[model samples]
Each structure stands twice: as structure tokens, then as C-alpha cells.
Target: MNLTRTWIALIALSAGSTALAASGLTGRAFALAVLALAWVKAELILRRYLHLARVPAIARGFSLGLAIFLMLAAGLALIPA
Candidate 1:
């Protein structure tokens, strides 16, 4: 994606996350939804701004690592705290 489009997407995702936070939802589902939005925003920044899309192998590695970390975070978020 182009930088302009990526920027717009990031903005939209931020808006969505903010809306979700203000929607009075709670629990694991809400946490996962916010985290998913965060994942997309991170991916866009990584690919477009960081120019990682040109390197498919490195991009996949970073994306996979991020996915693993987010999954673990999601799991932890599900635990009572």
C-alpha cells in the first residue's frame, strides 16, 4: 500500500479502537478486538513506513513474531487479574 493509504488506514484503525473503548464493552472479547486492531496498525507501519514489504522473508518473520506475541498477550488477558 502507498504511504497515504497506509496513513489513512492507521487513522481509521485508531478511530475504531477508540470507538471500541468508548463503547462500554468489557472482558476478553474487547481486549482481543483492540489487540487485533493494534496488529493491523503495526503491520501497516511495518510494511509501508518501515519498507518491509519489499523483503517478503523478513516481513513474514516480523509478522509471525508479532502474531505469536499478541496471541500470548491475548491469552494472558483472558486470565483473571
Candidate 2:
């Protein structure tokens, strides 16, 4: 995607996340939703802004690392404190 489109997408995702946060929701589902948005935003930044998309291998590696970290985070969030 072009930079402009990426920027717009990031803005939209941020707005969505903000709206969700303001909705007074609480739970694993909410956390996962927010984290999912975060993951997409992070991918956009990495691929478009950082130009990681040019290197397929590196991009995949970064994406995999991010997915693993987020999954672990989601799991931890689901656990009772």
C-alpha cells in the first residue's frame, strides 16, 4: 500500500481502538481486540514506514516474532491475576 493509504489505515485503526477503549468494555476479548489492532498497526509501520516489505525474509521474521509476542501477551492477559 502507498504511504498515504497506510497512514489513513493507521489513523482509522487508532480511532477504532480509542472508541473501543472508551466504550467501557473489559475482558479478554476486549484485550485481544485491542492487541489485534495494535498488531496490524505495527505491521503497517514495519512494512510501509520502515520499508521492511522490500526484504521478504526479514519481514516474515519480524512478523513471526511479533505474532509470537502478541500471542504470549494475549495468553497472559487471559490469565487471572
Candidate 3:
């Protein structure tokens, strides 16, 4: 994607996440959606902003780690009241 497009996407994602937060979603659904958003945002940063895409191997490794960490975090957040 073009740099301009990437920036636009980042802005849009940030706004979308903010809207999701303000929508008052609760429980597991909310936790999962928010965590997924976090992953997307992190991926965008790592790829476009950090230029990690230049090294496919490192990018894959980092993405795997980020995914695992976020999934665990989301799971913990969704645990009962």
C-alpha cells in the first residue's frame, strides 16, 4: 500500500477502535474484538511504520509472538466478572 493509504488506514483503525470502546460492548465479545483490533494496529505499525516487512522472517516471528500474547491477554480479560 502507498504510504498515504497506510496512514489513512491507521487513522481509520484508531477511530474505529475508539468507537468500539465507546459503544459499551461488554463481556467476551468485546474483549475479543478489542484484542483483534490491537493485533491489527500492531501489525500496521510493525509493517508500515517500522518497515519490518523488509525482513520477512523477523516479521513473521514478531507477528507470531504478538498474536500469542494478545490472545492470552484477551482470554484473561474475558474471564468472569
* Ten-residue region with minimum lDDT total, candidate 1: 1-10
Clashes of each: 0, 0, 0
Clashes of 2: 0
Off by over 4 Å in 3: none
Best by TM-score: 2
Tens digits of lDDT, candidate 1, 1-81: 789999999999999999999999999889999999999999999899999999999999999999999999999989987
| Candidate 1 TM-score, C-alpha based | 0.94
The whole-model C-alpha lDDT of candidate 1 against the native structure comes to: 0.94
Give the per-residue lDDT of model 3 (tens digit) for 8-51.
Answer: 99899889889998999978888888888879989999998889
With a 3 Å backbone cut-off (N, CA, C), the pairs that clash in candidate 1 are none
Question: In candidate 2, residue 55 scores what lDDT?
Answer: 100
lDDT of each: 0.94, 0.96, 0.89
Candidate 2 lDDT by residue in tens digits, 3-74: 999999999999999999999988988999999999999999999999999999999999999999999999
Which runs of model 1 end up more than 4 angstroms from their true locations? none
lDDT of 2: 0.96
